[model samples]
Structures are given as structure tokens and as C-alpha cells.
Target: MPTLVLDTLVNAPIAIVFDLARSIDLHMYSTKKTNERAIAGITSGLIELGQTVRWRAKHLGVYQTLTVRITKMEKPYFFEDKMIQGVFQSMDHQHLFEEQEDGAILMRDVFHFRAPLGPLGRFAEWSFLTVYMKRFLEERNRIIKAVAESGDYVCYC
Candidate 1:
């Protein structure tokens, strides 16, 4: 398994950033370049703990579908989602938020995923998947930060 971690500072309230992170609508907006969509389960609105969401998207020039369940949550502080079914052997993404004294939020993402096919998968991770996934997460976080900072994230939730 390869893990990717990212930390970002957003000029927004912790609650706003947290909600935007879980908003299905904001996800779709962020992934517009990939044409990602929630096709099953919670198709819109904020995803709560224990809920499953099925997403279809085009990545690496291939159309893929992945299902994930929100396994843990702690209001505006933290949340974890795990893959139920997807291209990876296993996938887990944890989102954490901390409020700064300046009233902004420090957001962090910890993502872990294991590809299939044994050695080949490890090679892929080393050669490309790791970098690709990092960029993917960065892009998503960029959108989240932008939206949350703009104070319009409430409209998506």
C-alpha cells in the first residue's frame, strides 16, 4: 500500500470546510475535469457516517466506478472513508481539520491505497499511480479550499 498525505490551509471555518469536504455536490464540482458523478447511494448533499456512495468517473482515460463508505466521523474535526469496491485492492481516505487561532482551518488528507496484481501493482505505484493520485488529491483539495474560503460552500451543503 502507498499512502499520500497532504496539508492545506483554508481561510474558512472548520465547520464550513468539513461540510464542503463531504458534500457530494462539491465533489462533483471539484472533479468536473474528470466528469465524476455520484450514480448510486447518496447522490447529493452531505454524506454522513455509515452511508455509502457510489461514484463513476473517468480517470486515466478509462471509465471507472468506486464505492466507498463513510466509516468514521467526528463532526468538524475528522472523518474517514473506506473503499467498498474499486480498482484498488483497498483504499482509505481520512480528512482532518483543525481550527487556527486566526479563525482559519488547517485541513489534512491522509490517503492510502493498494493496487492489485502484486508486483505489477507495486511497480505501478512506484512508477505513476502514486504521483497521479497525489495530483488528484491536490486538485480536489484546491477546489475545496477555494470554495470554502469564498464563503459560498454553504450553498453546496
Candidate 2:
């Protein structure tokens, strides 16, 4: 398994940042380059606990569908989503939010995933999947930060 952790600072409230992070609309906007979209289950608004979302997207020149369920949520502080069905053997993403003294939010993402095909999968992770996934998460966080800081979260939240 490979784990990727990222911390993004946003000059916004924790609640707003949390909502935008779980917003389907905001996700679509952030991943437009990959043509990612919520095709089923909580497809439009904020995803809640136990809710499953099926996403269809193009990655690495291939189209793939992945289903994830929000397994845990604690309002504006923390949330966890896990893959129910996807190309990966297993995937877990934890989103954590902390409020700063100045009213800003420190959003953290911890992603852990294992690829299939045993040794071949290990090679993939060591070669490019890790970098690709890191870039993907970074881009998503970038958009979330931009939207939260700009007060544009009203549209999605």
C-alpha cells in the first residue's frame, strides 16, 4: 500500500472548507481536466455519511469507474471515505480540518491505497502511480483552497 498525505491552508472557515471538500459540484469543477463526474448516488450536493458515489472519469488515457462510500463524518472537522469498488485493491481517504487562531482552516488529506496484481502493482506504485495520485490530490486541494478563500463556496455549499 502507498500512502499520500497533504496539508492545505485556506483562509476560510472550517465549516465552509469541509462542505466544499465534500461537494459533488465542486469536485466536478476541480476535475474537469479528467472529465470526472458523479454519475450515480449522491451525485450533486454534499455527500453524507453512508452515502455512496459512483464516479466515471478518464485517467491515464483510460476510462474507469469507481464507487466510494462516506464511512464516517464529524460535521466540519473530519470525514472518511473508502472505495467500495474501483480499480485499486483498496482505497481509503481521510479528510481532516483544523481551525486556526486567525479563523483560517488547515485541511489535511491522508490517502492510502493498494494496487492489484501483487508485484506488478508494487512496481506501478513505485514508478508513477504515486506521483500521479499526488498530483491529482494536489490539484483537487488547490481548487478547494481557491474556492474557499474566494468565498465562492456559497454556490456549492
Candidate 3:
């Protein structure tokens, strides 16, 4: 398994940042390059605990469908989503939010995932999947930060 962690700072309210992080619309917009879309379940709006979402997207030149369920949520502070069905053997992503003294919010993402195919998967992770996933998360966080700081997050949330 590989773990990827990232922290993004946003000059916005924690609640707004958290909401945007779980917004289906915002996620779809952020991943437009991959043509990612919510194909079933909670297809739009904010995803809550126990809600599952099925996403269809093009990655690595192939189209894949992934289903994830929000396993835990604590309002504007924390949330956890785990993969129910996807290409990976297992995937868990934790979103944590902390408010700064300056009113900014620090959004941290802790992602853990394992690839299939045993040794071949290990090689993929060591070679490019890790980097690809990191870049993917970074791009998503970048969009979330931009939307949160722009005061236009209300539309997505």
C-alpha cells in the first residue's frame, strides 16, 4: 500500500472549505481534464456519511468506474471516504480541516491505497501510479482552494 498526504491552505471559512471538498459539482469541475463524472448514487451536491457515489472517468488512457462511500463525517472538521469498488485493491481517503488563527483553513488529505496484481502493482506504484495519484490530488486541492478563496463556493456547496 502507498500513502499520500497533502496539506492545502485556503483563506476561507472552514465550513465553506469542507463543504466544497465534498461537493460533487466542484469535484466534477476540478477533474474536467479527466472527464470525471458522478454516474450514480449521490451524483451531485454535498455527499454525506453513508452515501455512496459512483464515478466514471478516464485515467491513464482508459475509462474506469469507481464507487466510494462516505464512511465517516464530522460536520466541518473531518470526513472519511472508502472505496467500495474500484481499480485499486483498497482505497481510503481522509479529509481533515483545521482553522487557523488568521481565519484561514488548513485542509489536509491522507490517502492510502493498494494496487492489485501483487508484485506488478508494486512496480506500478513505485514507478508512476504514486506520482499520478499525487498530481491528481494536488490538482483537485488546487481547484478547491481556488474556489474557496474566490467566494464563489456557494454555488458548488
Each candidate's TM vs. the true structure?
0.98, 0.98, 0.99
List, residue by residue over 90-139, the lDDT tens digit for candidate 1: 99999999988888799999999999999999999999999999999999
Q: What is the lDDT, from 0 to 100, of the residue 66 in candidate 3?
A: 96
lDDT of 2 by residue, 71-129 (tens): 99999999999999999999999999998887778999999999899999999999999
lDDT, candidates in the order shown? 0.94, 0.96, 0.97
Q: Give the TM-score of candidate 2.
A: 0.98
lDDT of 3 at 42: 96
Which run of 10 residues does model 3 get worst, by summed lDDT? 146-155
Candidate 1 clash pair list: none
Q: How big is the positional error of residue 49 in model 3, measured in Å on the Cα after superposition?
A: 0.5
Candidate 3 Cα RMSD (Å): 0.5
lDDT by residue (tens digit), candidate 3, 70-105: 999999999999999999999999999999888889
lDDT of 3: 0.97
Model 1, position 157: C-alpha lDDT score: 74
Best by lDDT: 3
